[model samples]
Target: MYTKKNYTIKRMLSWTRRYIFMFILLSTIPVVLYEVLDWKWLHLPWLPIGLVGTALAFIIGFKNNASYGRLWEARKIYGGIVNASRLLATMVNDFITNEYALKDRTDAEFFEIKKSMIMRHVAWMTALRHTLRVKKPWETTTNNKSDQEVMKKLHIQEYAFTLEEELKDYLSKEEKQAVLSKTNKQTAVLNLQSKAIKELKLDGLIDDFRHVEFKNMIGELFTLQGKAERIKNFPYPRQFATLNLFFAWIFVALLPFGLMSEFEKIGETLNGSNHTGILFQFISENFVWLTIPFSVVISWIFFTMERIGDVSENPFEGIANDVPITTISRGIEIDIREMIGDDKNEIPKPHPEYEHTQM
Candidate 1:
């Protein structure tokens, strides 16, 4: 996500420049035609255009609100994962003991068990993030060409390594193969985690209460996983998205036509005998053409807002505005491994930022 407090003007311009260029071209067409050809019929009344703009504003507002809700919800879900992961690591360290075991186990064996479970949890995170980053046909980040180019420059997280490569560090060869073979790798990882904990309970390494607590923690992970999957699999309703674009464009198209007449009136008033300065009079006389830039600016606002909503609606898409799942996953891996007493060198560093955004 954009970790910086505010987007720099340079960065904002980089994103919006293409849209601004398109708007300028779109607005210039009618103004050039009207001024050169004297096509008085090209202009539309400002009142009706203002009403359309008002309605379009409301529609865009609704879409942006919905998009923000999705983005914030995804962040909260991952935040829960962060907290639960720490709790899970702490519980694993504390709960497993020889006091409850049917057979006497050494401290080394207990350490190994804690290590295994923690590594498995890391594998689960790897699987979950990889699943979320899988490209959906509807996701703008993957579907848009220019967006893909920008993402390449920023070096998105999922692209840094294949899921299998990352999982190899956390899972045994057989377990990795089993997970890769599954249709839903994340769910499989969680199931393996549950079975492992149950085996611990059966062997009396952990008490019954601890076993239940372990299962409950796994269940919470399941819920969080389901929440993330829901956002990834389900897209915003296409009807609303499609129509919002259409209406916004409609307003943009009619905007210059309406503004041209108002500008021409100003031009006429200035061209009359009331104007004394030649420079001011000439500028005002040519003000009708100024509608192009004015319209371009206004239309740019609407188009950029719509585009922002489109990109924000899918928070797991590995775009600049996405939830930074890869960073979060790596952070959890570091935290959990450290909590379980893994060597400092064995723990991977947290994902770093590029262009002020953590991917």
Candidate 2:
């Protein structure tokens, strides 16, 4: 979804702002209380705290790695979608021929069949892409070739707009973005469009040559769909995540106790001077602040990274770097309409800004 190779840096900074604030707040609270109380911690050893910190660090590392795996899986699925969509487009150009165009089916029927089937396929691609990305549907226009002949023949000017309006309500941003990563939406659109091919085969519009070609394309589309479904429904095992986080938490919570001994020894050497005591008070006052809050920050950073990774790998879910399913679907609609001779420029043009921004 993020076309830029290093785009995750920006994404991390933006999404983690709230976590940073919360972690800091949690840390600062303890520091302030200890400084005010001027309390002395008589006898705890710091060894335990060091052990906890090291253990938690390892657990956090595992969590980050696992989360990344899920995200990468989503990326691979979208790669398939991109290939499948291009293949379908190519097949559309391959299968339809002059043989069917010059058949016993009347001039009107011939044009109607060709036009209807092609445009629908285009719509199918758009719909599938959008569905994966969960984007709104749009009017079926073939680029900017708006002409009266194309519109009246296809009946798209009126009908397409309605579909667009309906789609506007149905597509949610998160779903659209997440789906884009796996290229799942495009696969779905292809499934629906498969019916058209089946109907054509039944009606004797498409001959054996065209039928075979279309069948192969359909298989690829379905394959893409299955792969996406697997990734979405079965993200990496949760058991590992739970254990790692639990252990990491326990380790982080106890880290400061080890460090505390050193801090207290320094205080004793200072001979409890009111001024030195004031400083010790300041430092020790926030033991929880230094250890617990710091651990929380470290924990939050790891968790937040995992969360962002979860959303990004899917890309069709409309997270910051998610693929824009709505836009792609609309583009497919535009292309298919034109390929089938439905050139109503009335269909919306792809936005350059949005082009790069889609999941």
Q: Which candidate should be chosen as best, given TM-score against the real structure?
A: 1
Model 1 compared with the native: what TM-score? 0.95
Q: Per-residue alpha-carbon lDDT of model 1 for 25-92, expressed as tens digits?
A: 88899998999988989999999999999999999999999999999999999999999999999999
Any residue pairs clashing in model 1, and if so which? none
Query: How many angstroms is residue 184 displaced in model 2 relative to the true structure, after the best TM-score fit?
Result: 13
Which parts of model 2 have CA positions greater than 4 angstroms off? Answer: 1-14, 25-39, 42-51, 100-115, 122-192, 202-205, 244-252, 255-300, 309-315, 331-344, 351-359
Candidate number achieving the greatest lDDT relative to the actual structure: 1
Alpha-carbon runs more than 4 Å astray in model 1: 1-7, 355-359
Give each model a TM-score: 0.95, 0.61
Estimate every model's Cα lDDT from 0 to 1. 0.88, 0.51
